[model samples]
Target: MKKIYLFLLALCWAGVSFGGDFVVIVSKDCPLASVSTTDLKRLYTGKLENIDGTSVSGTNLSMDNPAAVSFLSEIVGMATTDYKSFWLAQQIRGGSTAPAVKKSVSDMISYVKDNANAVGYVPKDAALDGVKAVEVK
Candidate 1:
């Protein structure tokens, strides 16, 4: 029984570590050095249109990706279904749109590289050729 309990605890820890194996990234030239979680949530949910008076955009990976799922759950604080519904509600209220969804992590990185004001999350070890990870508060 003790061994089984230890194994389960280890399994849970592995899951948490695996899910956390990603980074929130932005263009290397982006204005902000770090972002509070509140600001990030606002930016992603479309409640915010700018950061430090500079127009900024958010990008999302398709929820089918484990990185995306983990990002949504841990950082965004929503499951895929809730995130979709929240976006739908925002759209219906006539003011916001969901973040652009990228097909893959590479695509997400490319987006951040090209869009100076864009923010996204990708696997921690993903090649960050033209982008940089921002500290999340």
Candidate 2:
């Protein structure tokens, strides 16, 4: 039992280490090609109205998904509850609400490609056909 538990722990740790890599992406027509963490935070919080001068708007994959949570904690540095609460406060303060979350990375990618101004992040291995990957600092 102890050996099995240890093996499971090792497996989980390996998965986390291997799984955290991610990529930020935007539509080809999106004005911005890359973004800083500051800009991303602003955009996610609705403080920045535009990316590369065009209006920015769109949703990301939801917190309930592991990849989404990993992206938030590893890339954006916010825990799920904190991230949602942050957006809620932003909405209450008249800042734009957090973008509506999609059900899957595939759905998010499709949504972003169609929306022009939409942007999102996904696991690094995910296919990026229509969207351009952005460098996130």
Model 2 worst lDDT run, 10 consecutive residues: 13-22
- lDDT (CA) per prediction: 0.83, 0.77
> How do the residues 12-36 of candidate 2 rate in per-residue lDDT, one tens digit apiece?
7654443466678889988776677
Give the per-residue lDDT of model 1 (tens digit) for 27-66.
9888877777778788888878787777888899988888
Q: Where in model 2 is the C-alpha error above 4 Å? A: 1-20, 92-95
TM-score for all models, in order of appearance:
0.81, 0.75
Query: Could you tell me the lDDT of residue 117 within candidate 2?
Result: 78
* Model 2 residue 10 CA deviation in Å: 26
* Alpha-carbon RMSD, candidate 2: 7.9
Per-residue error (Å), model 1, residue 2: 30
Give the top-scoring candidate (lDDT).
1
Candidate of highest TM-score: 1
Worst 10 residues of 1 by lDDT: 12-21
